[model samples]
Target: MRSTTTSASPLPPRQVGEIVYRPRVPHIMFSGYHHQPDATLETSRDLWWHTGDLGYTDEDGYFYFVDRKKDALRRRGENVSSQEVEAVLLTHPAVSAAAAIGVASDLGEQEVMAVVQVADNTELDLKDLFTHCDRSMPHFMVPRYYRLVDAMPATPTGKIRKAALRETGLTDDDWDAEAAGLTPTRHH
Candidate 1:
């Protein structure tokens, strides 16, 4: 197999259960990965190439790209988009920046965790943030864990490093809403 310029990564097959841009019928997605036959084989199956993206088509047949499959959170048996969660979080006046990621759940799935940076001269109130999030999105999509940080780990290009946030496993600074009895109940 000849190596093409590049083919990105394929998400872990376990996370591929929900959303991915796979070719239903035979189509040329990519030539092959450079010097990575295992990766090539992992992505291509039975003449189908899994594009490792999380999304769904609306009733009108418009494909909505949610997140990378690897970055998506599986919460309460639903696929949650970290990007969508972050978008809701960012709307809060106290949040300067936010990064939503998955943390391990006792149920052997992933739970949504939001790492946030507060705006200058503003204090982030977890309860207020929760109420805002609850109003802005579905209950399951609201973050279960929240961590307020002075600054988010970022690349030189200013992209939040979600990988870095995930590496900090179960920190004391992280707040668990379930333990705190903060539920996202519907308001009148």
Candidate 2:
């Protein structure tokens, strides 16, 4: 004989808090401006929502998310901040601007990579820059690969177009040794 069983009825969703109550919650706020009040409140109150970011709260009540929620590089089980690495690269005198992205490594871990735009008529030394990072940032934060470009692709508002760079995959031919003071040899 065959027996049939009915699944239990689903529970009705509960309204824990109103949208206006987001500011009252104690949590870390990200660096970006919170313009969409509705979305922010929903994300904060939803239990299923993972902020997917690293952040902290101040004693007073202000919250701050330090790193990007997305685009975090996983290197040897560590989360490396691409923005942090890019900020370090910008400190170099030769670098006008930079954008850091993650590239897949042979070891199945993500490697930090940077695409930098140099100052007018100036060039960077890849080895020296790497040495600087070694002294300044943690090992996981240092970029494993570097690509020097004339200028970083940016949006009208000056935001770096990281998606475009990622789509272009890191090919050996993309490296500009001359711009990076690496013996002027083409990667290809």
Model number with the top lDDT: 1
Q: Rate the local accuracy (lDDT) of all candidates.
A: 0.77, 0.63
What TM value does model 1 have?
A: 0.75
lDDT of 1 by residue, 110-180 (tens): 88888999999998889788889889888888888899999999999998888899999668878888898
Question: What's the count of clashing pairs in each model shown?
Answer: 0, 1
lDDT (10s digit) by residue, model 2, range 1-188: 00001112221232111111223454654623368877655444423333445444445544544465455677777767777888889888889989888877777877778888889989688887776666668766777678889878899999898888888877875553334653312111
Which parts of model 2 have CA positions greater than 4 angstroms off? 1-53, 58-62, 174-188
Worst 10 residues of 2 by lDDT: 1-10
Worst 10 residues of 1 by lDDT: 1-10
Highest-scoring model, TM-score: 1
